[model samples]
Target: MTQPEQVTFPAARADATVDAVVARMRALDAVLPARDGVAVFNRVYLTVTEEIGRRLRGGEFPDPRAATALDVRFAERYLTAVDADAAGLRPPACWRPLFQLRRHPGVRPLQFALAGVNAHIGHDLPLAVVDACRAVGCEPADLEDEFEHVGEILVVLEERVREELMPGPDLLQLADPLTHLVGSWSLDRAREAAWAAARALWALRHRPDVAGEFTDRLDAVAGLAGRMLLTPLGHRTPRPR
Candidate 1:
């Protein structure tokens, strides 16, 4: 859509080293001053991915190959979306909000980050899970451990991002639009939902029509939630004390 003028984060196809991933994310992050929402989300995702890699190295996953397969598959969904965007084709419905609002002046960085998380967890993730199961030649149940572990790490990192970017003072008590928006979406719930959706998709794999409809509905709902999260609450004019 409109060439996605704001985001230029390159599409990643083949797997790369952690350093390479970090560099790609960091390069985009350097322009945060420009308020690129995609970059903020990319950084968050990168951090979570790095943590997952560490967990994989530490033998935390029962089946390391499955975990790696799942991670890579999950990433491909997003990267493919990016590639679609770059080609002036529509990315997934879920990613549309971030691409549209990446440069919105009234949207805070945290909102951008959370919206991206919502889109990924609610939409891309279930599909990723299905892709992983197929690639690893297993069922959804087989990769449950990796899925849950990744979700846990993601939750932790999301909290860290909030703390780092949250405006000082009592945000919760201020009746802030952001506080309400944040309440409307929960990463924990989104992760659980993704798991359920993944199982459903896997079960209906033989029924492509049913599976395709389910995925479309999921993407649209996630996109709606993301748009709500990215709603531009105009900046308050500071009172002259």
Candidate 2:
């Protein structure tokens, strides 16, 4: 495998603030190619973060401090995964497929975007929940509202992305394998799985071994779905409009 492209994001450290995360994402947006798969996902995620930041400023979250902590921790997981990939170290199972398939000519931008969503929500969100819980000194139940709110934003974003990226009416034939391929993944299912995983991890927190094993399994399962989403169709597909 080739060394991944060098895209510098802020280090995922104890003091990594949300502003720093947004700044790093913006930097990535400025430098990465528009057509790059990771760039596609990064743009969508950056939008989501910007919206969250706006909401935070608007006093939308019931517990603003908790929300900020959750958002920053959630983003750090994705950044950490990317950093690991860049260093040629093993990333989490969910992220490996995207990093490996990032430059494939046959994969469409929408596929790249959706695959990143899958890995983040499926594998990263649940763990991030636990991280936030620890940081906020609260239980997962306390962050439920914020979690659902963020998921709602992602659901809306996914719909718009699908609408914008879908091929024209002339290319919407059921016979096209791309149709079935794109239809296989669902953000709703991923969101549901994330909540369940969060609850399970919270329950197993005292048992580090069990929690570690469960997260590993979740990562591998999500990675499998990402790999399926990224399957190269051997033809050029329309990029997102």
Candidate number with greatest lDDT: 2
Across 213-240, the per-residue lDDT of candidate 2 in tens digits comes to 9999999999999999999876644444
lDDT of 1 by residue, 1-241 (tens): 3334564566665554444555555655665454677877888888887788788889998898888878877776776676677678898899999988888889988888999889888998999898878877999999998888888889799889988866645634366777677767788899989999999999999999999999999999999999999999877545345
The TM-score measured for candidate 2 stands at 0.92
Candidate 2: pairs in clash: none
Per-candidate TM vs. native? 0.88, 0.92
Badly placed stretches (over 4 Å) of model 2 are 1-6, 168-173, 236-241
Q: lDDT of candidate 2 vs native?
A: 0.86
Which candidate number would show the highest TM-score if scored against the true structure? Answer: 2
Give the range of the ten consecutive residues with the poorest summed lDDT in model 2.
Answer: 1-10
Compared with the true structure, the alpha-carbon lDDT of candidate 1 equals: 0.81
Cα distance off (Å), candidate 1, residue 17: 7.1
